[model samples]
Target: MITVLVIGIGTGSPDQLTTEAVAALNRTNLFLVPDKGADKHDLATLRRELCETLIDHDRYRFVEVPDPDRGPDAERATDAYRAAVAEWHAERARRYAATIRDQLGSDGTVGFLVLGDPALYDSTIRIAESIRDDGRLDLAIEVIPGISSLSLLAARHKITLNRIGQPVHVTTGRRLPEEYRPELGDVAVMLDGSLQCKQLLPKHGDLTIYWGAQLGLPDEVLISGRLGDVIDEIEAARNAARAQRGWVLDIYLLRP
Candidate 1:
């Protein structure tokens, strides 16, 4: 059986790696890095840097796979979106299975480094399950937790996620409803490439927003203020950074 470690490397920052995560990295015989094409090549570069800095590169092998594209369809229909994502994931599973079979030893451990906690919005855990379900390979899976971008965003802003007795709602940009619910306390939005916060500002002008992009790395950008006050600033900054870096991963918290 091959032991697959789904290790969380923690949002582009090596320092955010926990001791357990470091240990998991050191135990890997192969590291699977997904190359999301030219626009996001820096992501794979970061993974390589992590491996080079944390473990002995000579003792382990690195496998790079081109990430599946989700297509340019703007299909907001529930079934259409589900179908698109499912198809993409299926392709990823095939790639993962091929790499495991071709590169991993029969009894050695392999690793897939995730950006945040695997339980969050990451799809690695789901992909692994799909591979296991296919039953083509003998696989044992282990997950190692690491600092999440959400937690790190709050830390960088020097604020707690929730107020006194308030609750926090975590969601993605696609699922963010058109209506704002004040009762939800605070909302942390992730995987949002659409600048959803800007759209919400017109409706909830009084709300406060804490936004951060490329959190942890040296080129990180942070903006926080009343939604109405800093909406344009955040938009400009996000666009400029994305154009400069060819890609961007940003998150924001909305407080009512």
Candidate 2:
């Protein structure tokens, strides 16, 4: 049987890795690093650097598996989007199964270093479950949680996620409108490629946003103010980040 550990290494900092995550890193016989190509080569390069710095021994090896594209239509949240995501996940599962079968010993451990906690807006967990349920390999899966961008976003802003006894609501950029009621407390928005907050400013005049991009990385940027006041600033920052780094991963807390 092969045991796979889905370890979260946090957004972009080595310090974000938990002690257990680091220990799991050293235990794996093989590591699967996904290559999304040159535009995101910085991502793959960072993973390789992480192994070089953290792994105490050279007994292990890492392979760069070319990641399958979920494509353009999958970017939206809709029935077609769901279908595209399902197909993309299926492709990923096939690649993962082939990698494990070809490279791992029956009893060896494989590690997947996720960017954030697997339970939050990440697909590695589902893909691993798919492989296990297929019954083609004797596999066991484990998860070691790491600091999520949401957590770090809160930390960087130095604000609690909730107001008083109210709870924090989490939703994606596309679903922001559905979850827009401020009475529900603070809403943490993620996976927003478009500046969806602009739409809320007209009606929700009191909306405030605490936003950050590339949280733990050197390119980190933070903004906080009334939505109407800072939306343009956030957009400018996001655009500048994408222009310079060719990519930007951002999250924000909306207080309504």
lDDT of 1 by residue, 120-216 (tens): 9888888888888888678889999878999999999999999998899998777776645788889999888877766676578899999999899
Prediction 1 TM-score vs. true: 0.96
For candidate 2, lDDT tens digit of each residue in 1-256? 9999999999747888889999999999999988898888888888889888889999998998989987886256688888888999999889988998899857799899899798899999999999999875788999999899999998999998988888998998888876688677889999988978788877985788999999999999999999888888899999999988778899999887
Local lDDT at 69 for model 2: 84
Candidate 2 TM-score versus the reference: 0.96
Error of 2 at 157 (Å): 0.8
- How does residue 104 of candidate 2 score in lDDT? 80
Off-target runs (Cα >4 Å) in candidate 1 are none
TM-score of each: 0.96, 0.96
Clashing pairs for model 2 are none
Predictions in order: lDDT: 0.87, 0.88
